[model samples]
Target: MGDLSTTDRTRHRRLREQGRTGRQELFDVLGAGFVCHLGVIVDGAPMVVPTVYGFDSEHVYIHGSVASRSLTGEGRTVCVTVTHVDGLVLARSVFEHGVNYRSAVIYGVPRALEGEEKLEALRLLTEHTAPGQWEYARRPNRKELAATTILAISLEEASVKIRQGPPDDADDPHDVWAGVLPLSTTWQAPVTDPSAGHDVPDHVRRRAGTRIG
Candidate 1:
C-alpha cells in the first residue's frame, strides 16, 4: 500500500525519526489494540474518555450510551489515540529512560449511524473486542439497541509512531546495565459464568493461551 496522505495537522514536526508514514502501519497500530482514548470538548471543557473501539478499512467506530454528552454532537471534531507499550527501556541515566511503544493518533469529525449501519457497527465492535463472542453469544435486541449510540469516524487523516530497541545511552560509559524489558498481554483460562450451566464453546476455548495485541 501507498504511504498515508498527510495534512497540515497530521504532519510530524517533532521526533521525525519516530513518525511512520505508511498507511499499513497506521492500520496495524489501530488493529492491534482494543481500547482508545477519545479526546473531545464537552460543555466548554476538554474531556478525554477511555473506551473500546473497532475499525474497518476506512472507518473507526465508537459506542456509548444514548445519553452520553460526548456522543450527542454530530460533525464534531474528535481525536482518538491508541497505544501499546512493548517494553521499558532502561538506561544508564534517568533522563535516558524511555518506553518502547507503538501508537496511532486519528483526527476526524464523527457522524452518527442509523438503522442497519448502526447494528453492523455494533457487530464490528463486538467482534473486535472478543473475536468469536459475537457469534457464540446472544445478539442485541431492539430495546437494547435503542439505548445505545454509535459514531463513525473516517480514518483518512491519521499518524502512527513507533519506538523500539535497547536504550540509546551508548555514549554514557556507566557500569549500569541497559536493556529492554519486554511486556506482553495474553488471554488466561476462561472463567465460565455461574448462571450459564453449559460447556464453553469451541470458539471461546480457541482464544485461551493466545497473545492479545
Candidate 2:
C-alpha cells in the first residue's frame, strides 16, 4: 500500500531523486504493460531477450519455447524490466531533455514450473496480454503445453521509477518552445478474421478506442 522495503541490491544510488520504493508503484508499472525484457547470462555472455510476461502479487511469470536458452535453465538469477513511455519532455537544453515514463526492474532467481502450475501461468500470461482472452480462446492441449516453458521470478527485490510533467528547464529562458509531447497507445477497431464469420466479442469490442499500456 505504501513504500516497499529496499534491499542492498534494490537501493537507489544514481538518480536517487527519481527512484521509488513503493510496492504498489511496481505493480502498476507491471500491470500497465504486457511485454518485458528479460536479462540473463547465458554461456558466459550477457543476453537480453524481449518476451511477454504476467505477474501476481509475489511473482512474475514469463514463458517461451521449451528449448529457449533464456528459460530452460533453473536456479539462475535474472532481471526483468517493464517500461511505459508516457511522453517526451522537450527542454530548452538538450542535456535537460528527458522522457516521461513508468518503469520497473525485478531481480530474482527463476524457477521452472510444471503440471498445473505451468498451465495456470500460461493462462495468466494470456489474460495479461488481453483481459478475458484465456476464457474466450481455446485452452492449450497436452502437446502444446509440453512444448512450452514457463519460468517464475520472485518480486521480492525490485525497484520502480516514474518521471512526469513539463521540462525541468522551465526557468531557463530559451527562444524555443518547451513542453511535454504526451504519448499513448490505443486499441484500434477490431479486425475480424476472414475464416471466422462471427462478429467481435463484447469483451473485445469494449477495448476498442481504449488506451493501452
Which model scores highest in TM-score? 1
lDDT of every model, 2 decimals? 0.87, 0.86
* TM-score of model 2 (CA atoms): 0.93
> What tens-digit string does per-residue lDDT give for candidate 1 at 14-80?
8788999998998899889899999888888878888999999889899855227865776678899
Per-prediction TM-score: 0.94, 0.93
- What TM value does model 1 have? 0.94
User: What are the runs in model 2 whose C-alpha is more than 4 Å off?
Assistant: none
Q: For model 1, name the residue pairs that clash.
A: none
Model 2 C-alpha lDDT per residue in residues 75-152, reported as the tens digit of each score: 677889999999999999998999999889999988879999999888888899878989988888999898788888
The clash count for each model shown is 0, 0
